[model samples]
Target: MSVDGGHRRITNRLFYWMAGGCGFATGVVGAAFHLAVDRLLQWPHWLADRLGTGPLTIAAGAGVAALAITLAYLLTRYIAPETAGSGVPEVEGAMEGVREVRWRRVLPVKFVGGVLSLSAGLVGGREGPTIHIGASIGAALAEWLRLDKLDFHALLAAGAAAGLASAFNAPLAAVLFVIEETRRQFRYTFRSYVAVIVASAASAFGMELVGGTAPQFRIDTDALPLVMLPLFMVLGAALGVLGLAFNKTLLMALDWRAKAFARVPILYAVIVGAAIGALAFVMPMSVSGGERLIAEMPVADLPLKMLALIAVVRFVGTMASYPVGVPAGIFSPMLTLATTVGLIFGLLVEMALERSSFPVPPLTGAAFAVAAMGGLFSSTIRAPLVGVVLAVELTGAFELILPLMVTCVTAHVVAQVLGGRPIYEVLFERSERLAGRMPSVRSAVTSSPVGIDDPPRSETR
Candidate 1:
């Protein structure tokens, strides 16, 4: 018994070391992929400036964008279908043992495909894809090294936390995100928790080394007015409704595309790509994933009418792109929409309160926008704690915790009243259906009886 205990201790230490190393590597690679996509997206603007605008120039730009998006979509459909649309669901499904993590194919496909789709001005973000891909990489490495099933799961979660940390530079939030968002199926343990924290910290450090540290969004510190709380509650309610509609529309669109273009994913991709390209030419702001738009909101000072129009267009574009099976995320686009709505609401409030000579603080709306971001996500996904932590971490706005809680809780309550289920739960159910139709791999790993008090198998040693 003494000898056995000593051996177990040694094994545990080794597992921790491996998990840390894999987490660090995942962080570095995921950060690199994000930076590369950013640079690639800027290339088109540089090219347009160099070549004088004419029919030929316009046609060339459109053709390039279309081809790039189509190719990206095709790769996602053919090579790594699971990498499609904000891979959070995929990760959640994998955690539940309802989906397989084919890291070998998924990592490369998601990295390259995500870059292409975003560069071509598709409405999406890299956060979801990065997390999914990073987790797969961890899982693959663990399997290759013949790690135990528990350690494999821990490392996978660590990699996922690292990816989000690297992408958003939100270390604490990444850890909280994994814990809160994936609470149901994630085999949580002390070792896994520590692994997630270590990975997130390393990823944040890596991002700072490469790009320098800056919060994802900058906002002035201002308390939300008491009067505005009611309005915010109203906004939260509206977002709850919008969240439900968005999910339904997105799933329907994907289902329709699958049926209409059965076995012809390539052709369907081309059509979606062309539509995005055309939208890019016409409503440039609405074409992309909305990152640039969000960054420029303060400077633009868009009027209510224009903001309303943009919000509508963005909603449609996001729905179309996401359901078409593209490898992208909805986080950035949702932020964009929230910002638009918040700004419009602020502008109207400013007009009504014209009696005050003080400059209408733009930060008020920005704060609400930030909070609404989490609120919508919480409402749709039913992960309030994750939403609050994610928003705080991504934005680096610790002061807005109260507002975030308020908004998220309000939105969640309203969504629940509307009878909406969590988005990931729905996806997991879908994955279970698929899993049931496939062969099981239970023979590959030792069958340890899991008990109520048994630590999740994914924990390190």
Candidate 2:
């Protein structure tokens, strides 16, 4: 090989190493964050058991949640405002050169604030904070090593993939998420994306070592019959409508919060946190991220009315929780809400089938619940492939892939027909307008065409 070729080969290898190392570290950190949040989450239930059912027990729960959420909100408000909410939009903006990562402030604030807010029984997912934290870790590494702008960008994407992989224990889904969800922002190149793949694998490895190899949600069922495909499509269309409403309501709540609590935002946090915490006493399923509820759905014998009530309560709680200026995400809550809606549909179908004397399995509702996860995700995120893969990975429900695909595709198409935009993209634009800042005119990295054989320049940031 020519000298230039040899140098390029070595350079690619080094870049891969850096990306993998960053991913591994992110996985380690992400696992610890999950474990810590899980442990902290038990506190409220433990307290409830010890205190018994009474106004004092409720008051204690409310006070603790209020204090935790308030502290978390203050950290983001004073230390790093960009760490507010899920931080997904911020990371996307940073990728487009429109926002700064501010790793020094972001890393610590996001970690502690996320723990406090999520463990306070706020209805939000941990994945968003983990994604932001992963990107920040990549940023820190790139800055310390003084890599080129292109490498820095690549590392950020890799870190994001690693974060999701660790969060869901789904490496392939993580890679797809970067490729599909962040496609607009991510700089696509063979080397860069391969680095992403490597990082995702390493992150998944680290996550498994620390968090065990079990799927995030464990529910299994037989393969869905092709005859039932139309039902899944209908389910998808329903979820599309739900997704549109979800985005609209969330944005409306955010706007209202901005106008009503502009000066005293912390008060909003106190109210939301206290309300949710107290409600946890009577309705624990409606207050949390809903992972436990989702896992238990296969066996839980909840009535249809109770399911509807839980869904409504969770929908309102999620809308209230996210706008409290605390670190939170909608992914987990979205999954839960979709599951409830799907199970409702499934139960209704079973009732109709029974009236007609058709046999229905006990686990059929669970099948629909699993498929709805991908459907709603597809509609909300506008990334059908990622949604399908994520659901399959999270549940290990390979048999449901056919239904998942039908649901995701129909959901995507229906959401588009309804003129609903991808939630993250809308959020990014709104953030830019709110901050009164224009996106930077200069692109971060320019390189050869996506699949070409060229290395990025060595210019330092």
Candidate 3:
């Protein structure tokens, strides 16, 4: 018994070492993916600056976008279909034993395809591909290390945390994301939990070393007064409605594409890519993930009509782009949409109070922008804590934590009360049906009402 205990101790230590190594690899890959996408995205902007936004520049942009997106689509459809879309659902499916992570194919395909598609100014985020990359690294390591089934599963979860940590440089939020988002699939042994923490820390350390430890975006704002709590709650409720609509529309679009582009899907890619690429040349801020837009957009200075127009365009852009079967994520796009909507609300409130005795702060729009980031995320993802942590971490707005909490909880409650399913679960179901592992009892792209506390109804898992 003593010998057995000693062997177990050694095995545990080795498991931790493997987890750390896996996390470090994920961090390294994620950093490379981020840097590559950023650098590649600069080429178009540089060209457009020199050539001006004329018909030629627009045509060039369309051609470049078309080529990039077409290549990305081919890679996913022919080489690795699992590399398509936000890989979060695929990772979730893997955790539930419903899918396999083909790391060998996924690693290269997701990296190249993601960089190409994202650089082409597609409306998506990096977090999804990064998370998927992290999980693939974990799977690769697990196989190479000959880990047991349980250890392999734990390592996959750890890699997931590492991925998110690397993406936003938010280690705490990454940990919460694994805990809240994958609670149903993750095995919760004490050692497994510790492994997740270690992986997240290691990945964050690596990412910070390469990309600095600053927040992803900064917002200059003062704390909200107690009198504004009710207003934030109202914003949360409104975001909940938006979240439901976004989910429904996104799914419906995917469903439409599955039937409409069944035979010649590449044609669909060309059309979307060309149109968005041209739009990038015409209205550069309207395409791509909304990270730069969130960081640099002058929300306070923009008119209400402009903000409303921007919001609509982004909403439609995200809906259209995700269905193209490319490597993309909705997180950044969703945050951008939420920020625009929030700023719009703030502007309205400011206008209302401008005539009253109550004076509005100049940065009120920014504060609401911060809160709405969390609110919309909570409503759609159904992970209030993850959304709150992500908002605070990404924006460095600690003073607005109370408002963030109020909005996130209100949004989550509203989404739940309205029976809107979590977006990832909805995506996972769609993936399962597409793979022919699950029966299509309902419409391919429509969302069904799911209870807040319900477990995923995947029988194959």
Candidate 4:
């Protein structure tokens, strides 16, 4: 066989092995990271309970947590800025060949920073960091094996899916997330698809062995009342608007911070920490990641006015916490926002039909809130399938698949009609423009011209 044919065969084999191996490794890392964060988060709550007071009254506890979170953000910004924020945009830029991956720096920094930031009560999710870390691992391994760039890209993609799979224990959702959201950059083919599936499955298997196979949420299976469907649709539309507003608020916060504190970066984080500390005293729910709130929201008998207040606080708090270049994500905040709205809507419906025999259980609102969590993500990100699958896996609400699908599809359509772009895409463009200002080695090579006698080209001669 010719050299080219031999090289092709070797590349194909390497691609498969790298993709599979990276996926498995990502699962292991992601699972371990998630478990560690969960354990660490328990400490503050335990301490608060021991003191016979809420988080606010425990002054020492709240101060320590805020300090730790602020330090983590500083470390991320100073050591590895790329690991800051959701990290989804970084992977997208890498796939587009617009950004280079420095695995040596990114992997460790993101892992440590993510653990610290999340544990310190930052309003973010582990999945974002896990995704970026997993991709870094894949790319590093591929480089170590001396694989070609194309094969490396495949492995990176597979690892990203596997990371998400392990983080949420949702393999199918992970695969669909990469396929749908990364469609613009990913070269979709039979081989790539198989690689993604294998990675997701392996990650899921690993998570099951370690964390068990239970879904994230324990939602009731009762069908949503027909009367509530219209309410859900309206919630979907509102969420779409909310999503846009969320994005705008985040950008504005960042802009304001940049302009106000152009010289002293640390002060930015200090101010946020101070604000969070104060907020913790008044409204603890508005400060930390929405995980605890999400879990407790179903059982809380909050009035509509209270729920609305919490929703507004969460929205503003998320915007404030995120603008300081912290290594965090929006998933938790988005879920909290949706749940708040859904709960309020359900309360209104209950008051309107108080005389009816068929009363809407609180769990129904919880379920709709869960479904809206996915719908808002789908609409904002324009990845309906991923959003739907993520909702099912996170909440274990597969029985409500029909309603979930309806909510997500409708939200996606509305978001598109409203002229909104996917959140990650917007961030990626921002990063690209920032990175473009720096000089690159590729410019040198492309700038040089080929001599007439260079080599016999493939052109007709």
Candidate 5:
């Protein structure tokens, strides 16, 4: 690249490393910020228990949650509308120069709005919004350094990797996710790849420094018999269809919410929050940022009927809470949904296998729950390696790696055969259309050496 000095400038490894440091800070901040939200989540439960689960208590709880969510919605609508659901797509669009990034607006809005939205017991996760916040910081820093858009892209990717690593305490998987899932937008240079690694490791360290070293989930899963390998394939096929249906429902939910928000705006947030607030009273296990619930599910001893009900409601809640332009993510929700489906499937299979002479692992349900994390993620994100590593790293369920591979790969192929694109690609297209632009998702994805300039041909507005 030519510079003002009439000299060629290569990718700056210094700035890349500096971006890694920035990502460390972002991870520290993101972890602490979400930890605050987790603390705040206790207030409603405390108030309810103190006042008793009477009608007045329920009313107060619901009112507070609704009010909190309504305020968050207001910020999103009025301040920075780009702070909405799974900002990953927006970042991808920005990298392609298809969408602009106003880091000044996005950073504060996403952080504050995400905190408020999650605190309201919404069915969302921290990783997505944190990823946005990190990218915003990266972009802002690039501008501060007087760097060009090229450097901005690398820093943005570095920060994003840090965000995921910090949130899940899985550095390697975070890097893989960017390399695989966002490879369509990220221009991978040796410097950029190194930056990603540094950022991911730094972020994980930062998070663990603040939070404890506990895994995201508490499970001691035993290694499964290779004899049951075919079972995992069947499980994968099930999750593939389920993930396809999930994407379809999420898209429809986004459409429904867009119309609702157009008419009533904040009322969409109010109604959803109020309803979920009420539901939380009876099935307290069904609500929250989602990951904790997944971990608790196996140990909770909830009956099959109640478990099914919670899973379905949480699935609907995720569909409802995220797509309404809320400052949230579908990551934890997808894991929660996948875990439930896997648990239920395993339980049913265990019952059937109990009568048969076929040998099955004693901890079948737990194994399935652990492995299904990769399966659903593979289908939705279409990045099997990332999904597998992430699931194992987050849950510390490494005993079933073989099965996880089987499940994730099968699910990925099935989803592809059924003609499902990655969820983020679809979201990117939808967001662009919403903003009065048309871009080719196919060509951009297939293009070599992705770059921001020269967007691929598309149907124009």
Candidate 6:
């Protein structure tokens, strides 16, 4: 027994070391992916500028986007269908011992496919793919290290936390996200909790070293009047409705694609990619994951009509691109859509204030943008703590925590009352029903005996 204990201790140490390494690597790879995509997207702009012929440049740009998206979908369809959509569900399911983690397939396909899909001006975020990538790394290393099934799940969560931290430089929020958002799958043990913290810290540090430390969004407003709490709640309720609409629309789109277009995903991809490509050519801000759009919101100060138009385009783009089954995330896109709604709401409030005699601090666009982001995310994702923490952390606006909590929780409750299930839960259900019927569709989960207190599975061990 003494000898066995000694070996167990040494094995645990090695697992920790490997898990830490995976976290560091997640940061590095995530940063590199960001840089690479930025540079890759720049080439089209560079070519267009040099070409000096708008038609020629536009055609060239569209062609490249079409080709890149075509290749990305092909890779996903033929190689690994698991690399589709927001991968948070995939990681969550893996933790529950439901789906297989083929890092060998996931790592390369996600890297290459994510680059192509994102660079092609799709409405998606890189962080979701990065999470999948990070979990794959941990799973691969755990297999190489011969860790038990229990440790495998722990390290996987640790890696996912690291990936999210690397993406937004929000280590604490990332940890909370793993613990809160994936609470059903993730069982917190002392070793697992420590691993998650260590990994998140390492990922944040390493990513900052590579990508520089900058808040994802800069907000000038520090606080809101207490009188605005009711308004914030109203905003949350609006966002809750928006969230329900967004989820219903996206799922409907997915169903339409599955029923009507699954037979020819490639052709469908080309048509969708070309439309997005054309939009990219005409209005670059209307396409892609929407970081640029978010950054421009405060400075551009566009009119309500223009903002509404842009918001509609963005919403359509998100709905169209997401259901096509490529490697991408809806988080950033959803945030973009929600921010637009907030802007519209703020504009209406500002108009109301202008007409009224009440004197209060005028709400800034930045404030509404940030608040609505969390509110809609809370409603759709059904992870209010993650949404609040993420907003506070990413914006570095701890002052808004009170308003955020109010907004996020309000939205969450409204969505619950409206009977709109979380988007991921809906996706998981779709996956199960479609798995056998559709060759391209795959389930994120299956019934597994592995639970929080389950002993190590003999097969996995």
- Summing lDDT over every window of 10 consecutive residues in candidate 4, give the lowest-scoring window: 444-453
Ranking by TM-score: 5, 3, 2, 6, 1, 4
Worst 10 residues of 1 by lDDT: 444-453
Model 6: per-residue Cα lDDT over 257-363, one tens digit each: 87787677688788877777767768877888887666568567789998899889899999999987888988889888887888888888878877899664644
- The true-versus-predicted C-alpha distance at residue 277 of model 2, in Å, is 1.6
Alpha carbon lDDT at 79, candidate 4: 82
Candidate 4 lDDT tens digits, 210-313:
66332155555457766667766776787777767676677778778878988997787776766665455456788767776776776787877789899988
Higher lDDT: candidate 4 or 6? 6
Instruction: State how far residue 25 of model 3 sits from its true place (Å).
Output: 1.0
Local distance difference test scores for all models:
0.72, 0.83, 0.85, 0.72, 0.80, 0.80
**Candidate 1 structure, TM-score to reference:** 0.86
TM match of model 6 to true structure: 0.91
lDDT of 1 by residue, 112-225 (tens): 888888878888876877788768877877776666556667778888888777666777878877776666545667777787788778777766666633225654446665
lDDT of 5: 0.80
* Alpha carbon RMSD to native, model 3: 4.8
Q: What TM-score goes with each of the models?
A: 0.86, 0.92, 0.92, 0.86, 0.93, 0.91
Q: What is residue 224's positional error in candidate 5, in angstroms? A: 1.0
Give model 1 RMSD, 1 decimal: 6.2
Better of 1 and 6 by TM-score: 6
The residue pairs that clash in candidate 3, if any, are none
Model 3 residue 70 lDDT score: 96
> Over the stretch 1-461, how does candidate 5's per-residue lDDT look in tens digits?
34644322345667656766767787787877768787777877788778888888778778878888888888998999988888889888877777778989998888888888887788888887888887887887777766666677878888888877776778889899888887777877777778888888888777777773322666667887888889899999988888888898899988987786786777888888887677667667677767777788766656678768877988888888886567888888899888888888888888888899977677788899888889999999888888899888887887889999999999988988787778988988887787787875544443324322233245332
The superposed Cα distance between candidate 4 and the true structure at residue 222, in angstroms, equals: 1.4
